[model samples]
Target: MRQTRRIAETPPPEECDPRVEALVNDLIGRVADKWTMIVLEVLAQRGELRFTQLFRLVRGVSQKMLTQTLRHMERDGMVTRTVHPVVPPRVEYRLTDLGASLGAAFCGVWIWAEDNLTRVEDARARFDDRQT
Candidate 1:
């Protein structure tokens, strides 16, 4: 049995095609949004969740923002929405394989942030002091 280490390197600029670069940049912009990242994290952890459950789990997110974020994720094929028909419609959202992969990829960013938090706070404090 072998354990594999995750690599966080990016391809060199010359190796990236312009169109692909543009699309990747756009996708990064979308997925890097606070709400999107939070939603991805929650779904990755909780498996499947109802809209209301998600709203509750994702603290401080408004119902409208959750709805919008879920729609965008579904549109991007990152999540699947299942509607259960009954007296009251029950809808649940689960991450697609693509979404799970994205969450795994973003884990590195979370790690980086955690590792750099103290440094970042010091830098911010210094900058604020200089501004005063």
Candidate 2:
């Protein structure tokens, strides 16, 4: 028998539990959304934010969509929602340790994008020219 030593290799399906595999798919779908990534970035950078503040910071996201995304994040244990006993029932959101770790993991992807931006743009331009 032979074994792979590749550092970036994904686990063999036979080695993965079906429930965990399904959860991975679900998680990717959730985190792959534009709003979720933007929200994560904002929360990671800005520390804690009020609902209105996040709405303002994450431009182009409607209040309803943002609310849904935040609720999902909260359910995933990525963000903590705090409600203050105040005049208008103020609510605040901050990243949990898990979310911060996720942000840290994605920092590598950002760096990769920065390094490869030119190559990607050139590839797109070439592809577009071919399509015309």
Candidate 3:
């Protein structure tokens, strides 16, 4: 019988294709943006939300920035936007399965950051002390 490999088990750096590496790096840069991560977290936790609700949930985001972030996420297949055919034309945004998976993947990073917060701060302090 043949064994199957999982998507999480990536090839070693030396064995990775340069194009694939470039694409992955590009995707990470885009998806790891503060606004993108915040939006993803909000949607993941809240399930689905209207524009006004999202705007209120994601504090510090401007209307233009929120719209652009939603458009980008939709383009990347991470989110779905739906419009209701009502008098006010209600619109809602929700995370797609892919988006939820991405959020799950990021959970490890968030955990690491929280766990190492004090260590990181101490390191920064040591570096500053050394410079002074």
TM-score of each: 0.85, 0.89, 0.84
For residues 1-132, could you state the per-residue lDDT of candidate 2 as single tens digits? 886545468656567789887986887788889899999999999999999999999999999999999999999999999999999899999999998887787788799999999999999999999999
Query: Residue-wise lDDT of candidate 1 within 5-108, one digit each (tens)?
Result: 34366445566789887878878999878999999999999999999999999999999999999999999899999999976999999999999998898898
Q: What is the lDDT of residue 94 in candidate 3?
A: 99
The residue pairs in collision within model 1 are none
Candidates by TM-score, descending order: 2, 1, 3
Give candidate 2 misplaced runs (Cα > 4 Å): 1-13
Best by lDDT: 3
Better of 1 and 3 by lDDT: 3
The predicted structure with the larger TM-score, 1 or 2, is 2
Local accuracy by lDDT, each model: 0.91, 0.92, 0.92
Ranking, lDDT, top scorer first: 3, 2, 1
Model 1 global lDDT (CA atoms, 0 to 1): 0.91
